[model samples]
Target: MRRQRPIRLQHGTSLHAIVLATAMTFSGASALQAREAGSAETSDTQVRLPENAEIQLAPVLVEGQERSAGQYTATVFTGAEIEDLGLFNSEDVLRMTPGVNINSSGGTNLSSVFIRGVGSMYLSDVTDFMVPMVIDGAPINARHISLGTLDVDRMEILKGPQGTLSGPWGLAGAVDITTRKPTRTFEGYGRAEYGEQGQALLEAAIGGPLTDTLSGRLAVRYSQSEHWVTNDADGAPMANPSNFALRGQIFWDGKQGTTALVTVEHEDVNALPNLLVLMPYGRKPSVDLTPGLYDDVGKSLNRYALEVNHDLASSRITSISSYMNASNMEIAAYDRKIMQAQSGYPSEFWNQDNGRESFFTQDLRLSSLPGDTITWAAGLFFQHMDASYDTPRNTYGYTSPRFRDFKSNVYAIYGDVTYPVTSALRLTLGLRQNWSSTDYDASFWRGGVGSFDSRAMSESATTGRAMLSYDLTPGTVLHARYARGFAPGGYNMYAAQIADGEPFGGATNDMIEIGFASESEDKTFALTGAAYVNWVSNNHLLAYDSGTYVSSVVNADTRSQGFELQGRWRVGGGLELAAGLSYVDARITSSVFGPSDGDILSGNLVPDVSPWSALVSASYETALPPFLGLSSPMLKSIASYSYVGPRPANPQNSLDLAAYHKLDIHVGVAQDKTEIYVRASNLLDDMYDLYGYAVPAANMAYGGMARGRTFVAGISHRF
Candidate 1:
C-alpha cells in the first residue's frame, strides 16, 4: 500500500475567512429586504362583477412545458427542479440526465458528454461527432459547456440524432439550455454558500419590466474551490478551479404581434486537470512524479444573440442570429518520471497549446399554428466556424512545433409536419438536407525540417425521419420512429504526416425506436419507456499510432441497442420518488484499423460506454409546525443514488473500469422570502474510477477518480 499525505490548503487560507465573507454579503443584503418586502408579498383581491359576467379557470397541465408529442426521445429539467437538485454547473446537471455519461481528463473544460454511447473524446475543434450544445438558440462549443449554470430556466436533452432539427453537429444528440427571460413583474434572488475543500459560491439574478413594452434581466455567478487531490511530488494543491459568469438580456415588444430579444453573455474559467493515478484498483496513491511543471487550463467565452418572432394570421415567423468568440490556453506535463535517466533534464516535461475559435450562425423558420388536422414547420440554417491553434514544446521533444487553422461552413434546409389521421392516431415526417465544406492549413518543423500542408474537403448528406403515434388511453400514448442522421468529415491537423487526400470519411446512423408514455389521473404517477437500435456506418474512431506519435481519425462500423425506463410516483403526503434505468449494449462491428487481417475488431464493446446505469431518488416536503412563530415554514429532505456499471476504457477493450455507486442527500427549510439548505455529496466517500487511459510506452494506466465526500451549507433570499 502507498502512503497517503494529509490534504491541506496550500495558500494557508482559513475557512473562517470564507465564512465571514459569506456572512457579511448576506448581512449587507438584509438592508434591501425591507424595500423588497412589499413587492415580494403575495396578495389576493376580489371585486364585484356585472350581473351577467362569468369566469372560468383554465385547465392545469402537469407535464413538462418543453416536451411535445414527438418522434424523438427527450428529457426536460425545469429551473425549480435544477435548484432542488443543487446542480451548480453543466457537468453536474448532465450526469443526472438519463442515458448520458460524462468523462473528464481533469479540467472543467476538458470533458465530453456521451449520449447513448456516441461521443468523441478527442479535442472538439478536431472532431466532428460531438453532442451539440445550444443556449437560447445559439450553438456553442463543447468546451464552453462547463460554465456555471446561472439563471437557467430549463434544460432539454434530446436523445439520438437531431439532424433534421438541430443541424450537422447533432450527430449524437443535442442539449438545449434556455436561460431565464425577462418577466413582467420585478423579481430577484441572491445566494451565498460555503462548502468543504475550500469551496465558496455566490450567485444572483434580477429580472423585471423596464418599461411598458420592454423587459430586462441580469445574472451573475462566481465560484472557487481547491483540488480534491494533493501533488505529493511538490506538496502543492493538485487542482484549483475558479470561474465567473455574467449574462444580460433585453426584450422589446412591438406592434402587430412582433417581439424581439437581444442577449449577451461572458464567462471565464481557470483550473487544473484532475490528478491522474496509476490504476489497478487500490487505495489512492501518493503520486511522486512531475514536480514543478506548469499544469493549468484557462478558457474564456463571449456570446451575443438576437432573436425575433412575428405572428401572422395563422402562422408564425422566427429568426435567430448568434455570434460566439472563445479562447483557451492549456499547459501540462505530458510525461513524468521519478528521475532523469538519459535525458539531462528534469523529471517532468511540459508543453502548452493556445487556441481561439469564432462561430456565427443564423436560423430562419416558419411554423403554422396548431390545428386539429395538421401542424407544420420549415427552417433554414447557416453556420460558419473558424479555429486556429499553436502548440509550443518545452521538454520531451517527441513532436515538432505546429500551427494549424480550420474553417468550415454549413448550409441546411429542413421541414417537419404532423397530420392526424384519426382522433386516436397521428403520422409525422421530417426531412433535412445539409451541405458542408472545410478548409485546413498547417505548418510544422520536424528534425530541423519544415513542411506546410493545406487541403479542402466538401461533403453533403440528406437525412429523414418518420413516426407513427397512437393514443392507447386518455393519458397514454405509444409511438414508433425511424430516423437517419450523419456527421461531416474533416482532416486531422495532428495527422498531417498521413498520405494526402486520405481524409476521414463521414459517418451516418440509422435508428429505429419504439416507446410509450403514460401518466395516472391526478398526476400521482407517471412512466415512460423506450427501446432503440442504432446501426452506425463509417463511425469515427480516434486512434493513436505509436509509430508516428500522432492521433488520427478512422472509419468503423458500430451498433448500439438500448432500452430505457423512467418513472415518478408521488406516494402522497408530500413524499415523492423517481427512478430511471438504462441498458446500452454498444459494440464495434467492423474496423479498418486492425493490427492484422485475421485480428479485425468485429465484436468489441465500445469505449466509454456502460452496459447498465440507474438512478433512484426520494424527496419529502411538508409544512413545519410553528417554528419560532414563523408562518407556514416548509421543510424538505431529499436523497438520491446513482450507479454506473463497468465499461471499457479503450477502443480495443484492453482495459476495464469497475462499477461504482454514489449517494447524495439534501435538507432545507424555507419561510417567506428566505431559505437555507445543507447538501452532502458522495456521502459514503466511495472510491471509484470514472475513466481511465493507457499509456503503452510508459507501461502505466492512469485513472480519474470520482470526487470524495463533500458537505455544503447555503442561504438564499428572494425578492
Candidate 2:
C-alpha cells in the first residue's frame, strides 16, 4: 500500500536562489516587457523601437506601470505582437516567455504548461489544474475553453509559487488572460493569414458603446493546419485538422463607479492524436504514422461574471463574482504494434476518457491610499470547484472501467500593504488565511462485476508572501522576498483502480529570491537579473513504470535552482538588440514508492525541465523612403538566432535531448487602415528535436519533428 506522508516545507534551497537571481537580472532588462495589472505608470525607456512614430510605444506598453512592474516579476505580450508573429494558438505566444515550458500534443486543442519545473502530473493534454486562467477578472477553470490568440488586449504570465494569492492548485503560478473589453469609442480590428503546410487563420473583433452605460464586444477565430509529420509506415502525411472558437461579452458601466461583464465562449477541434514522446527507439512508427486512427475532441465553456466597486469615506470596495463550466472528451490511441497484448487485437490499448469541471469564485477587495507613505489592498475570497473523470477498458481488457470525482470549496481573506520605511526603502507584507473542504469518490467495474468504495478527504491551509525593496537610485532597485505555496491533493482516477490502494498526495513549496534591476529610463539600454532557490516537499511528479509503460503519480522531495538575465539595447538608427539566458538545476532529492512496494524511481530529473536556454535577437527595420505602392510607411527587417537548450528525458539523468536554434526574417507594409506582412521562421532549417526519449533496448529515439522552412503571409485591417 502507498503510505501517506505529512506535507513537508523548506526554505532558501537551490531552486529559490536560482529563480531569484534570474528575476533580479531581468527585472530592469529591456528584453522582457513588464506586465501591467490595473493602471500604473513608469518612465519611458527608448530601445530598439521602430522609427515609424506609429510604433513609438512598444517599451511604454511593456513598462508603462512602474509600481506594478517593480513589485512582481511578470511578463506581458500584447495583441499586436501576437498578430505580427502569425501564431496559431496561445501556446505559441507563451513559449517565448522566460522559464516557461509549453508542450502541445500536435493539435490545437491539447496543450500542457510547466512553470519553473514544478508540479507535472499530466498524462495527456489535460494538465494539472495549478494555473488559473482569468479573463477580465473572471477565472476560467475548464480544459474546453479554447485559449486561442484572439481579441486579447494582453496576457500576463505571473511566475513563482502563487499560493498566497490564488489558492488551491495555484501553488505553482497564475496566468491572467485579459481580453479586449468594449471601448467607449467605436472601434474594431480584423486579421487573416495563410502559410505553408496548409495553414489558415481568420480573426475578427468589434466593440462599441450602445448607451452611456452599456457596451459589448464579439470575437471569432477559425484556424486549420496540416500535420508536419509524414507516416513512415503508410507513406501518408498526417492531416492537419481544423479548430474554431467564438466569444461574446457585454459590459454595463453603472453610475458611481460600478461595472459588470458577462461572457460566453465555445470551441471545437477535430484532428489526429499526439505522437507519443517515446525515448530513443528505432524502427518504430509514430502514432501519427499509423493508419485507421483518428482523434476527435470537443469543448464547451459558459461563464458569467459581475463586478461592482464603490468609493467610501476612506477606502475603495470592489466585488467580483463569476461562475464557469467546462467539459472535454477525447478518443485516442497509442502505438498499436508496440502496445498489443492478450488477444493481439489491441483491444485494451485505447483510451476513452471524459471529464467535466465546474468552478465558481467570488472575491471582494478593499483598498486605501491613506498617505504617501502607506498603500494597501485587502480582500475576501470564496471559491468552489468540482471535477470528475470516467475511463473504460479497451478490447484488450487489461484495465477496468474506472470513475473518479473530486469537489472542493474554499474561503480566504488576504491583504497586502506597502510601507515606505524611509525615503529609499520600502517593505511589503501579505497574508492569506484560508479554510476549505475536499471530497473524493472512486470505483471500478470488470466483466459484470462492480467493486470498490469511495473515500473522502479534507484539509485547509494559510499561505502568505513577504518582501522588501530599496531604491539605490532613480534608475535601480534591489529587493528580497519569501513566499509559500500549496496544491490540493485528492483522488487519482487511473491509480485508484490499478494500484493496490488509491494514494492521493498533496504538495507544498517554499521559495526565496533576491535580485536587482537597473535601467536608464531616458536611455536606449536596460538590464535585469535575478537568482532563486526553491525546495519542494512532497513534490508531485509523474513517473512511468518500467515493465509496462504505464505511468503513475508520485510525490518525491525535489529541488530546482536557476538564474536568468535579459537585456535590450538600441544601436543607433533603426537597430535594436534583445537577448536572454536561463539556467535551471532540477533533480530528485528522494525516491517514490508504488503500490508494489519497491522504489518506482530513485533518482530522476523531473520531466519538462530545460537546464540551459537562451534567446538572442537583433533586428533592423528601416522605413522605406515612400517607395512604389507604399502609401503611409513600411518597415523591412531581418533577425538573428533564438536558442533553446537541451532537456533531460528520464530521472537517472542519462539522456541529453539535443538543443534547438533557429533564425527568422520579416517585412511589413502599412497604410492608414490596412497592413500586410511576410515572415519566415526557421529560415536556416536546423534539424533539432525539442524533446527526446529512450526505449528499453530499442535505441534512443528522439521526438523532435522539424517545422522545416515555412513562410507566413498575413494582413490586418483597422476601422
Winner by TM-score? 1
Clashes (candidate 2): 52
At residue 568, give the lDDT of candidate 2.
Answer: 65
- Give the per-residue lDDT digits (tens) of candidate 2, residues 598-627: 343544566567777665555455556676
Candidate 2, after superposition: displacement of residue 23 in Å? 27
**lDDT to native, each model:** 0.67, 0.59
Task: Evaluate model 1: give its lDDT.
Answer: 0.67
TM match of model 1 to true structure: 0.86
Q: Give lDDT tens digits, candidate 1, residues 1-719.
A: 11112111111113454344233222210000000000111112111112221211000011111123353666655565566456777776777665787766555445677778876645434435467778887777555556777898767677777755433347777777888999889998898989998889999999999999999999999898877656677776665778899999999998677999999999988875544554543444444445434345778888999999898998788898999888877764433432232133445544567778888999898876544246677899999989887675646564678778889998999988778878888888889998989988887768878788788899999988888888889767888888888888887655444352257777788888888877675556777788988888887765654323355567788889999887766565555566678899989898544431112276877777888987666665666877777777776566666667777766756566666666666677877667788988766566556567654444445656766779999988888
lDDT of 2 at 96: 61
TM-score of each: 0.86, 0.85
What C-alpha root-mean-square deviation, in Å, does candidate 1 show against the real structure?
9.3
